[model samples]
Target: MTERFASLMERKLPMLDRLAVITARDQYVRKVLIPMFSDEALDSEVRTAFQSGAGGYIYQVDTLNTAELKLILQEYSWADIIEGEPQLFTQVFHVVQHSPDEAFRAEVLAEIGPYAERGEIDGQEYALMYDRVELAAGRQQLYGSQLECLNGQFDVHDLKDPEGVDARRASMGMQPLQDYLEQGRALYGPC
Candidate 1:
């Protein structure tokens, strides 16, 4: 299944790449871009139409045909996309959902600590932490203060590999704290 998904992704690379460019240009789509254009669903022709600038994209499923391929890509619901990536999206969605106003601020707080300790968090691993915090925050699954403290201890040190850091940070907003710690600990850990 992974291989098939990978192959499909390869085939849809052009469309995905184009969609990414469009999404980046249009901040409105930034949140929903991942769900709408995940590697799994890219094979659907409807996705292709929207990615290619067909008619007009709609946020509503009724407007988008699970069967038809002509409908233009429309708006996206952050909730809907988060539903798709329950593990990660749920976390982010919940953080924003329950707290409504304080989500992003909380995120900054939660991330600051770990970031300080480790110096960085790779995109993928951070996604995991984001999801966890989102779930905790949204569902009240965990103590908010605990999360805040944990994130606070993180001390983002100088990037040892400036070149690599610049490359990844340029592409993605930030690196995962786990990755940074793993690398740093491996290099600097007591022998």
Candidate 2:
């Protein structure tokens, strides 16, 4: 088990590094370049580069997803991995979001909540996974912090059971929802 975990980490870390680079580059082209040069005005080479970058990032996402699926096929459970190797579960969860399996994400979400309750994983990681699973399922998010600016004002994605949000955040080592919202507004607002 130790040897297997070590090998998995060795492979995952490098792949994650490459994935981040390609994904960031792809985002830069979409968010930065497309705005600076309108879609029709982009040079062919620049356009092609953006297309290729997006394709490459998607390919990497597929590769990572397949790798994670293999890991899931193993006998390991979330608690086993979190208690033994710790960060492995978190790393897997990061790329696992790209996977199209709602059932699998739900499974992880259910399985990990107890571990988080036991302090097996940190609060931020727990909150992130919780918010992600909920949002992906088209349900309300627990943390009001996941915001996108609409008209320069930060708007909370629909939140589930908003009344208990601060307690949820506190349980997961997060600050109050209002405090997070304040920061989001300051950063994404003034409209």
Tell me, by lDDT, which candidate is best. 2
On TM-score, the candidate that comes out on top is: 2
Q: CA shift at 152, candidate 2, in angstroms? A: 4.6
Scored against the true structure, residue 13 in model 2 reaches a CA lDDT of 61
Q: Estimate the TM-score of every prediction.
A: 0.18, 0.56
- For 146-177, candidate 2 gives per-residue lDDT tens digits of 67656656677688888888888887788887
lDDT of 2 at 94: 57
Instruction: For candidate 2, report its TM-score.
Output: 0.56
What's every prediction's RMSD, in angstroms? 18.2, 7.4
Write model 1 residue lDDT over 67-127, tens digit each, in one string: 1211111233322222223343323322332222344435443644354245343344343
Model 2 misplacement above 4 A: 1-63, 70-72, 98-100, 152-154, 161-163, 178-191
